[model samples]
Target: MRTIDECRAEVFRRSEEKIKARRRARVRAAALCVPLCLCAVIMSVAFMLPKGPRTEEDMMQEDGEAPGGASGTEFSNDLVGDGRDDDVNAPGGEGSLSVSFSLTWGTYGISSYDSATGRLVKATDATRPEDYVTTYRLTDEETELISELIRGLDIDRYPDVYDPQAGKLGSDPSMTLILSVRMGAKEKTVTAKNIALTYESEDPDGQLFLDVCREIVEILTGTEAWQSLPEYEFFYE
Candidate 1:
């Protein structure tokens, strides 16, 4: 019973309602997707960003602190060098310097030099200073040379122990070397186990430690008293 105009007007109103409903659905969908897309983009950007360089504190935490509570600042190959010099008598005034080197494996031995006593003692098959196989007095020049070498070395930069990958080398027959140096009241001792292997393995820290040990050993073995001592009876593989 409705007129044609009324029928047409009703159709137009129904079409407008359908269009508004579709527009509301699209707005709701867009509102839901906008935050999700932003979150995804933020996460991707964060993941793609590069990390910053490691600081000295990070390295110190990883490698641990050096002997005498020293920081790990100058622990590099440039600081540690092979102990060889054309001029053994480098000019340096003498002070209260004491150095000792001990090697242990199949046999035990220790070599010690003291500037106060002007005595160098080398003992084998014994640990005490009283049991010395060879003893010699160091001249003023000899003491100065030793003092120069010991003072030149920054022993505080070295760790107390140098053993690379300790868990893997447990079964192997390793030789332990202990070097102790005292300048005035300050003293530091460094112990290395199988340092040759560590040197060969190319560990930077271990290599530096080995170099310091070599410097001390060179100072000890290069002496006339050390050269006069007899060879070892037992050998270690």
Candidate 2:
């Protein structure tokens, strides 16, 4: 009961359906491949870009503030401290021996001491005058000890002493020492840099400079002076 024409038409209909299904599958594959290709291209472009130097603005933004808030000049000053200011002396000719010091980096303070009256005065910032300067009278024994130590350190002999690492970019300087001596009509001053003998050197005598400076600091501001003003560390700039 099958006719040839009817069977032929049925075959044609099935072939059309097969062709449509293949077209649909191809469309789906193309859609999927397009996004994947685009994503790969984007990733490649990102990798190809070069990295540049970090700017001050970028650093400030990362720190969550504008410049000068903390990580800028203001913060540097805080770390350095406030101490170096003009001398607060009794009179021009009163000071017989005076010693002062400052650091290129780290804790900042500048102080001047007079051996004549055992008077020690310090200031942290030059711009702002000190509200209340810390003062202490060096004991007679301490004064004699300082004089002996100074001579032992040979500070006078080396008026412009410099460490081997001086002037280098990363040279570590302990502190800049300024010593002035007024004896009769003669007045002499010595400035020494990188005074700390932190590293071992062939010359054993190299340590005398640092030792003398440390002794001076300790004797000048002993426990009594620090106990009186707990904020002594912050006194330096």
Candidate 3:
């Protein structure tokens, strides 16, 4: 029943088993499409790369510089959200006044003034206030009580100038206060942090900036080079 040369050798053995089952189904579809096309080319080169570091809110959205430039929180949205200064209450006295304090058990203080040397500089030093120098002049009732306590504080309503852990406590000691003023060419500065449990918290505007930094640290420790360093005290309470 079969023989025409075994029916052409059973039609060339069923065309060589259908060409080796189509070359083993194209080598199992190229080994399953080359690892899924190399995992989609390594996820398209990891989403076209480029991104790592630059936070601090991306440097305040790239160049509105906060985080410690001009002592941080860079200024002027009409001097902190329209709290208004009207050019620091314009008047005749043209510029210059500074105040500083630094601590963490080393205390470095400074107070300055200048209406072309009308004089009022109470400098202080640390390592337990063991260094000093003082000066005074300007008597128009102490230059109108140091220009009405530096224009009655309200430092642009202080909403966080540099809160490096807002007035931390229990690190043995800590404190920092700095205020600056210069009317003519316009300069303004404010920094505070007198962490004694940040004034035992109850924030009424951070206890009115710790009660105007304890009346400017009692007017720079009531000068006379802090009363000739009488056992130098004022260890930030």
After TM-score superposition, what is the CA distance of residue 120 in candidate 1 from its true location, in Å?
Answer: 5.0
Better of 1 and 2 by lDDT: 1
Model 3 — TM-score against the truth?
Answer: 0.22
| Top candidate when judged by TM-score against the true structure | 2
lDDT of 1 by residue, 1-237 (tens): 999999999999999998897566445434533453354445445654447888888787756755444552322122211222221222333422234223222112244544444455564444343545555555556454444443344445567875643434433444456656543333567665553333333554444344444444555567787787666443545
In terms of lDDT, the best-performing candidate is 1
Is 1 or 3 the stronger prediction by lDDT? 1
Tell me the tens digit of each residue's lDDT in model 2 across 1-237: 679998999899999998897566444434543453354445445544447888888777768755445543221111111111123222432321233222121123255555654444544444443632455655546544554454344333444545523433223434455555443333455555553434223433343444455556656666375345434444322
Higher-ranked by TM-score: 1 or 3? 1
Where model 3 places Cα greater than 4 Å from the true spot, the runs are: 1-162, 168-173, 185-187, 195-237
The superposed Cα distance between candidate 1 and the true structure at residue 189, in angstroms, equals 1.6
Worst-scoring 10-residue span by lDDT in model 2: 76-85
Evaluate all candidate structures by whole-model CA lDDT and list the values in order: 0.47, 0.45, 0.44
Q: For model 3, what is the C-alpha lDDT against the true structure?
A: 0.44
TM-score versus the correct structure, for each prediction: 0.42, 0.42, 0.22
